[model samples]
Target: MGAVNLYVTEQYLLLKTVDTLQQKYGFRTLFISDARDEFLLEKYDRRINHVICIRRKTFDWSNQLKQDIDSYLRKFYQQPQLFRGKETRFSIVYVSNLKPVDSWEHLSKTMRLKGRKNATVTTYFVDEYEGLEELGKLTNTIDKNDNWKMEALPPISEQERQMVYLEQKIVAIHQHNQRKFEEIFQFGKTKWTFVLIIINLIVFFLMETQGSSTNSLHLIDWGAKYNYAISEGEIWRFLTSMFLHIGIFHLMMNMIALYFLGEITEKIYGSKRFLFIYFLAGFTGGIASYATNDAVAAGASGAIFGLFGALLFFGLHYKELFFQTMGRSLLIIIGINIVFGLAVPQIDNGAHIGGLIGGFIASQIIHLPKKTEGTKQVVAIIGLITLMSAMFLYGSQQTSASENPQTMAAIAQEYVESERYAELIDWSTDRIDQGIEHEFVYFYRAVAYLETDRLDAAEDDLFRSIEINEDFAEAHYNLSVISERENEIGMALEHVRKAIELQPANEQFKQYEKELSQKSTSG
Candidate 1:
């Protein structure tokens, strides 16, 4: 086991251990300090950290040690390079302060070690390291104790991975709770947080009972944010949509975030400010969605992001607690979410970003529940929010697409399905005035026209829809139905065949094809 070349963290001097290992394998010692010192690196004038690379003599360390070692470690990592071909070089390299990401599979292209023949690199994190696991992966993390008491190390176990995760969670929780003892006693209540979670859960249950949570129809009827609906003066959709969710996983994820972030933020800002920020952020998210997206969106993601923003604001106000305890973790969480939003498909990231910004603004407006309050800063905050609101309202009223074409289309289709042809036509005409001339809008309008015995108008709208989108399967199928109704069997056959070809898996289209074929044969 000693010859295998991995070491657990130790507290005392390893001189005797190093001497024993040195007899079997040649190794070099490099002591690195993660602490900062007021020294500059040579002529670069760059501030140097407390790191020192020692061989027989000392080497001054740059502040950017990770950037320095990622390349330096490449000499030890497996590669078809000059160093790998060399013999009589390093057999064992004992590095202190633990160079990170050696085992993370994602870093293989860069961190993969292909060192000199039979070379092994053993690493350790020391007492002064004072590291954060959230920054990166680390091994040997089961804390024997916080003090520097020397003891024999236990064998590494698989449970250490779970311990690492638990430790990260603990650190995250600790960051949230690093207030002074007096402040902890009067922690903000989470009445609003529980209320919000319960309301979301109830709404999700209602959604599951009706149809799939992911179903656009179910979501729209349940007051999910639809820009067209909002423009029609259904402003309540903004608040209602925030409580709705698309699936169990979506609901679970947001609720978990709320359980953690919401409680802390609400406690920090008080119930009133927390509630205000949550709803306002949700409203802002709705506005962003209306402006940018043409789909029905439902989730508490915006409000959850509001909580994150609120925490950041708290950190900013309490500079000491934030910088020393919370800032890195908060920034890391935000960065991760932002990256995930960019990478994942079907995520309502507009809502997340919009809510983050909106919540931050609200945090400034509504002062934290602290002894020291800034009256001037508060007034400035209100003025900024008011100015932003006025601009958004003016722009929304002016922009034609802000009326929500997709919302109109979804509503129109619902009306058509229910045989409310007059209402469908009215809504369709109203949306057209708002500049919503999308192919779905045209197609739904045509369906209403056909149902209301306006054949000529129906034919015109269908042709326009098909012209706008050549590959719209529903449009082609509907055109075939219109042709058959008008006794044009050949045209019906052509259109139905096109529909079937576009969506071969659609059984309805296949049935329509068979019906059209029979009609052509009879004619």
Candidate 2:
């Protein structure tokens, strides 16, 4: 009877400690048995990704305790789906009422030899055991006598009744956790995700109708991100380019990613918040791309990555729930995509990373639906504004044409279209001096020199352009013209033959080749 009473007191204390650990210390229920004799609880410090495990059981021998600990460690390693960390730092807390017959020194040595480098096991015995005082301090069970409750308890089997109560408490905790998880996603409806998808599809089809979406000139006309245009104060391209795409395949991929990511983000953040996050992410992503790249870029990749950032923010608030639901898979997918982007030279990873970080910052600015952190949100908003401003200022200051040939080429093309030969000559010369020794740059300058009647300079530049790019049909054709002017029919025929071979479908090359052949035959 006295043993039964002690068991009852210990069970009650165990239940109270479990409740306190969950409610106050933020521990999550990991495992619970129907018999309620044993259970496992875990707590994670989300900030550091550290984990603590608490196990409850009765062990009659030190070896039994050691065996259980070893088994649990095996299970932990085997079930990678249960957690995501490269090297998890695990601290296992073992709680029991019955003391082992032997000292734990041998078991401790065994654990040290076999356990993971960062794993450790600590034992605490309750109810008339040596570790009771230390356990009391940890669980807030000191100086509190729950033994009095056993006397008022029903005259039923004490252990069975306590087990039943413990099971009920565990069930209630699970129910509470489920409710909280459900509540977080219930605040918003998914509207903007679908709407954005429609908008992107519409824009893609419209862009195709205007001309080919793959055409750089057409893309620029339809508001793709062109660095030279942006540098010329067309800042609105940053926002508009997100709605554009480089090709049908690029559009399709982005829309697919957006459909899935947008739905979840919209449902979590609501339409207004989703819009804020999307645009902010896209804008920052564009700026980041602008700062690092001079390519004519377009897509919703930045905004899609921003959605990734938004979910990351959600995880920060509800770490345990996030891991339980989509954390592992999300992290794996993000890792794979990032690695793929790095390996592929054409991928705009700058935009991806920028949007990810921007989306996180944007989420911080708006916070959750009903939650408000006044100072934190304000700081986030200011910080984002300052960061974008700095990036924009830095990008604008990078004026060396040698550094961005695509932008320089675009500028040269603009001059060519407007018949500004003098300006083209001066601009190309400046670029050439700055080490911008591209085939197109030399060809454009040669054309300008030819227009100004500088035949020798034009011929020299044409030869240099062909030397840089052997497949430069335009340079070859122009060199043939210089040879023809000097009455060198054989050299002119040779140059025109190469031009015609390079561009078989060009009527101009064919016509020039025919003229050069006739001149050679007449000579």
In TM-score terms, candidate 2 sits at 0.64
Find the candidate with the highest lDDT and give its number. Answer: 2
Clashing residue pairs found in predicted model 2: none
- Given candidate 1, what's the lDDT at residue 43? 10
lDDT by residue (201-277, candidate 1, tens digit) is: 99899889977787666687889886566666887888889888988998999999999888877777778988988
**Candidate 2 lDDT, tens digit per residue, 141-194?**
211432212123344375567666765877698778767766787667888888
In each prediction, how many residue pairs overlap at the backbone (N, C-alpha, C within less than 3 A)?
A: 5, 0
Would you give me the overall lDDT of model 1? Answer: 0.61
Q: Model 1: C-alpha RMSD to truth?
A: 14.9
Off by over 4 Å in 1: 1-179, 182-186, 323-325, 372-376, 383-387, 394-399, 402-423, 433-435, 449-457, 467-476, 494-522
lDDT of 2 at 12: 62
TM-scores for the candidates? 0.59, 0.64
